[model samples]
Target chain A: MKLEFSGGVLTAFIDGEIDHHTAPSIRETIDKTILQDKPDVLRLDYSGVTFMDSSGIGLIMGRYKLISSCSGKIEVINIPRNMAKVVKLSGIERLGRITIKED
Target chain B: MKAINTMKLEIESRSVNESFARVAVASFISQLDPTIEELGDIRTAVSEAVTNSIVHGYKEGKGKIYITVSIFENAKVTIKIRDKGCGIENIEEAMQPLFTTMGGERSGLGFAVMESFMDKVKVNSVVGKGTSVTLEKKINGRFVTKW
Candidate 1:
């Protein structure tokens, strides 16, 4: 995962697969960035993500809580077509809008 | 369904091995010529069950995860994943969505996702023994030739 913060927006470019084993590190990195940078918007970019399970959902939900706790909103963007079903199934829209970046 | 082809995999319960286990099983079943949707669903389901073994089951310890992938005729498949870790005391509560034993780190959606993607998901466990998750999927995909 890669992190970039500009204009108070912290965007994480998630790559590869996300599962229970890999989610913690991604979560930790994002959380640490959120605290240190205190970005106004947390944007989780999934353009490079090839696969995900429910563990991905957990990562998003956890970040939602963390960001919202500190008054920051989260936006999940650029989801691959294949991974969109699981994302929708997780009901993450409550956290915010989920936009799929078109190729 | 009668299993015409079968393969067994045993891997150490390490976080790093999670992707290996799922991809291995997915590759094993790919001979059935599953559609992309079918393949993706299987990969996601396999990842969940194996991760459950590593996380909630083993819980920060080392163990072994046993996986059995069986390919039946007519593009149907079944995967059985087992682990000798601490078992769940309550299967019902555990299956509920967003009910994580690990709190915020986990989404508590493993079983639920398996149930969604697969045709059938059966979970059996003994408190002190281990847990076995069996996921079944019938591929209604395009025509295929079996190798």
Candidate 2:
């Protein structure tokens, strides 16, 4: 995961497979950034991710809780097609704006 | 049903081996030439089952996770993931959506994903013994076939 913050938006570029093993590090990074910058929006970019399960959803949900308490919003963008179904299944659309990755 | 091919895998319950476990099963079943969507679904389901063993069963401790993949003659596949860790006390409560013992980062959706992605999910556990989750799915087999 890589972070870029500007204009109160902290965007996390998450790549690779998200499982129980990798999620903790990714979560830590994002949480640290959120705590430090307290951005007005947390954008989770899933464009670079190749594989994800419910762990991905957990990551997003945790962020939602963190940012909500911080009085910020979130945007989950560039979701790859292969993972769109799972994302939709998690009913994440209710939490933030989702922009699907174009083929 | 007779198994056309079969493979067994055993790895310690570590986060690093999660990808390896899922990908190996997908590759083993690739002989049936499953579609991309099918492959993705199986990968996600397998990941969930394996993760349950690592995060819940083994509880961030050291234990071995056993996995077996079998491809049947009718283009059906079954993957069994087992662990010799602390078992679930309440299978019914555990399978509920958003039900997780480890809160916060845990989504509590592992079993839900397994159920959604696979055609059948059978879970059998003994509190002090171990837990076994068997996932079954029929391959559309659009890409190739030797049978």
Candidate 3:
């Protein structure tokens, strides 16, 4: 996971399969960045992610809570079709808008 | 109803093995020439089941998770994930969407995902005994003759 921050916006570039084994670390990193950077917007880039399950949903929900508490916004970009289904099924759009980049 | 092919695997109830289990199942079922969407659904469903065993059943403790997959002649696949760890007290409640006992760390969508992805999902559990989740899906007509 790589994070870039600029102009009150933090973009997280996450790669690999986001599952139970990796979600904790990802959550920790995002939380730490949100705390230190205090970015007004959190953009999650999921183009490189090969797989994801409910654990990924939890990660996003947890981050939404943290970012929303600070009155910040969250956006998910470049979600693959398969993952977008999971995200939509989990009703994550209620928390933030998910943008799918054309491949 | 005899299965045309069957495979069974037993692995430690560890988080790291979740991906391995899913990928293994997907590879095995690739013989049926499932579409990309169907394969993804099966992998996602298997991932949820194995994750439930590791997180809820084993609670990060040591245990064994058994995954049994069988492909029928009709192109229907059945996957059973069993764990000899702490089982749920109420199977009905556990199957509910967003009902997690792990506080906020979990999304409580394991069973929900399985139900959505698979045609049928059956959860059988006895507290202090163990839990087994059975998921079944029928692959639509998309057989790859190359295999």
Candidate 4:
């Protein structure tokens, strides 16, 4: 997964599967960006993502914790519905807008 | 109603390459108009399962993890993940929330996350053979086909 930071949005365009192995890097990348850039909106665009598991869940929850402390908002766009069901059940709908795009 | 289809992929238990997979699966399944919370739930659940296979099953060694998915006639989705590593001794105890046999850097929320996301989750393991997990969810009102 590659993370790009610009202006008030810290965007991460993740690819491949997100599990425990990938969470640390993702967390580090986003954390560094969030701390350094301190963006108002942390956008995670999942246009390239393919697979994910619960550790990926932990990643988002952890990010939510970090951004919440700084009063920053997190938005996840272009999420697939299968993953969307998992995210919605986690009660993260209150955190950001989850949109499904046609491919 | 259109006939449902199935998709399957086998991936290395490496964490570096899963982000793209997670995003792709999430984006593909988003036709159901899932909420952000639901997306997070699915990602977290998948993460836990894959991570468990990597850390616990393979112990960071090289191994193959099979992830198979199926979509039912009603747009229901099911994923089957399997690992041929050190299997579980007891499935019942393992499924308990906050149970961690690893005892390091883990909160033991894996099974909990999986059960929370998919409509149904089934796990089967043998002490010396392997482990398999099946996750299911219903995707309603989507017209897209399998990719």
In angstroms, give how far residue B57 of model 3 lies from its true place. Answer: 0.5
- Model 1: how far residue B146 lies from native, Å: 4.9
- Candidate 2 regions off by >4 Å? none
Docking class of 1: high
Number of the predicted model whose DockQ against the real structure is largest: 3
Better of 3 and 4 by lDDT: 3
Clash pairs of candidate 2? none
Q: Against the hidden reference, what TM-scores do the models get?
A: 0.95, 0.97, 0.96, 0.58
Clashes of 2: 0
Per-residue C-alpha lDDT of model 2 across residues B1-147, encoded as one tens digit per residue: 678789999999898899999999999988888889999999999999999998889998999999999988778899999999999999999999889898888888899889999999999999978899999999987755667
User: Is 1 or 3 the stronger prediction by lDDT?
Assistant: 3
Chain B structural similarity (TM-score) per candidate: 0.95, 0.96, 0.95, 0.84
C-alpha DockQ of every model: 0.84, 0.84, 0.86, 0.21
lDDT of 2 at A77: 96
True contacts kept of each: 0.84, 0.76, 0.82, 0.37
Indicate whether candidate 1 or candidate 4 has the larger TM-score. 1
CA lDDT scores, all candidates in order: 0.89, 0.92, 0.90, 0.70
Between the candidate structures 1 and 4, which one is better when assessed by lDDT? 1
Tens-place lDDT per residue, model 2, A10-63, is 999999888888988999999998999999999999999999999999999999
Q: Please provide, for model 1 over B1-147, each residue's C-alpha lDDT reduced to its tens digit, 9 standing for 90 to 100.
A: 578999999999998888998889889987877889988999999999999998888996999999999988777789999999999999999999778878886878888889989999999999989999999998776565553
* lDDT by residue for model 3 (A1-103), tens: 8999999999999999999999999989999999999999999999989999988889888898899999999998898877877887898888887776686
Best candidate, TM-score: 2
lDDT of 3 by residue, B15-88 (tens): 89999999999999988888899999999999999999988899899999999999886788899999998999
